[model samples]
Target: MKVSEALSSRRSVRGFLDKPVDLDTLRRVLAFAARAPSGGNVQPWNIVVITGEPKQVLVNAVALKIATGEREFPEYTVYPEALPDPYRTRRFGVGELLYANLGIPRADKAGRLAWFTANFRFFNAPVGLFVHTPTYMGLPQWADLGIYLQSVMLMLREEGLDSCPQECWVTWPETVRRFVPIPDGHLLYTGMSIGYADPDEAANRTNAERAPVDETTTFLGF
Candidate 1:
């Protein structure tokens, strides 16, 4: 698929079909996605891919923790303490759109929380990837990881697969560490679910809007 097509089609798919992804295809996608640029050639992204029994085990463990009201201190904050202006509103808007599609009203806090637990199960996707980085890496390295992740997502689209790049997984750093063999000195940065999207699911039908280029960009030299 063309780059433009991939970018246009790629969305944070929340529902996945039961079919498994081909391991060979996944490896090739990851290998090619590593070509994504990093500052000073420091390719800082590390990924632990899991599926089948291991993935289910991790999901069960996190479910137990959630049941017992256990919590882990996150390795890093996913968002600022107090987000400002358009950024904050944009975040809220997407979430509202998602829950609305799921038939969840703003008043249904419990329903929303229950739906959120699906992130641990990778939204029933067959493949799960946990991204990590050395704890010492700063903002620039983190940004590189985002670029690498975008490349992976786009390539998944090229292969007729879908994915959800989940920052929510960072909330269970300790639980994930117990299940995945993340290298020493590295922190779990995020997770992703990759598989065929469930076209019939309402959550999969939600498409969040984006700000126009004129609103988000500036043409200084043009």
Candidate 2:
């Protein structure tokens, strides 16, 4: 697929089919994703891919913890507590849009929590991936991780697969470390779901809007 097509079609798919992705296809996608640039060529990322029993083990464990009201301490803040202005507005808007698409009313706390719980299950995607980086790395390395993941997502689109980059998984560090072989100094940065999207799912159709260039960016010396 063309790059433009991949960018346009790639969305954070929330539900997926039971069909398994081909191992070789996944390998190829990662190999292609590695071509994504890194500052000073540090690369700065590692991943543990899980399928079958291991994936289910994580899903079950996290679901149990969440259901039992177990608290989790994430390694770092996922979002600022006091978000400012347009950024906060955009976040709230997309969340409302997502729930609206799911037919979840504003007052349906249980309904929303039920959907949020699905993050651990990879939205039913057959493959799960854990991304890692050494704790010593700074913000630049974290940014590099985002670029690498974007490449992976686009590559998945090219391979006729779908993905969701999930920062929420970082909240359950212990559950993830038990399943994935994370190195001692490395921290779990994020996770992803990879598989065929369930075409009929309404959540998959929830397209979050983006701000126009004039609003979000400033052109200089153009």
Candidate 3:
């Protein structure tokens, strides 16, 4: 697919069909994604692709934690405790939009929790990818990792596959580390769900709105 086409079509797909993604297809996507630029050629991102029994193991562990009332502190704060201005308003709007699409009213706390829990299940996708970076890395390296991840997501779009880049994995980092055997020096950054999107799912119909270019970017040179 053309880069523009891929960029325009790509969305964070929440619900996926049960179809499995072949390994060869996944490898090709990752190989292309690895070409993404990084600071000083330091390719700091490490990806663990989980499928089959191993993926189920991690999923079960997370469910167990939730059942046992065990909560993990996020490795990093995704958003500030107190967000200000347009960002805060934007976040609230997205939440409201998503819930509205699912017929989940703002006052239905239980319904919201149930939908949030779906993240741990890979949104019913067949493949799960966990991204990691060394704990010693700084902000620049983290930014580079994000670039690599975006490359992966876009590549998947080119392959007729869909994905959701989830920060929700941070809540079960230790369980993931143990199951995936991620080394001690590395920190689990995020998880991604990859597969064919369930076209019929109501949540899949909800797309987050983006701010206009004038609001987020400035063009200096004419």
Cα deviation of 213, candidate 3, in Å: 0.9
Q: Looking at model 2, which ten-residue stretch has the lowest summed lDDT?
A: 174-183
**Model 2 alpha-carbon miss at residue 92, Å:** 1.1
How far is 68's C-alpha from truth in model 1 (Å)?
1.3
Number of the top lDDT candidate: 1
Question: For every candidate structure, what is the RMSD over all alpha carbons to the true structure, in angstroms?
Answer: 0.8, 0.8, 1.0
Question: Which runs in model 3 stand beyond 4 Å of their true positions?
Answer: none
lDDT of 3 at 15: 94
Task: State each model's CA lDDT, in order.
Answer: 0.95, 0.93, 0.92
Better of 1 and 3 by lDDT: 1
Off by over 4 Å in 2: none
Clashing pairs in 2: none
Candidate 3 lDDT, 70-131, residue by residue in tens: 99887888889899979999989987888898999989999999899999999989999999
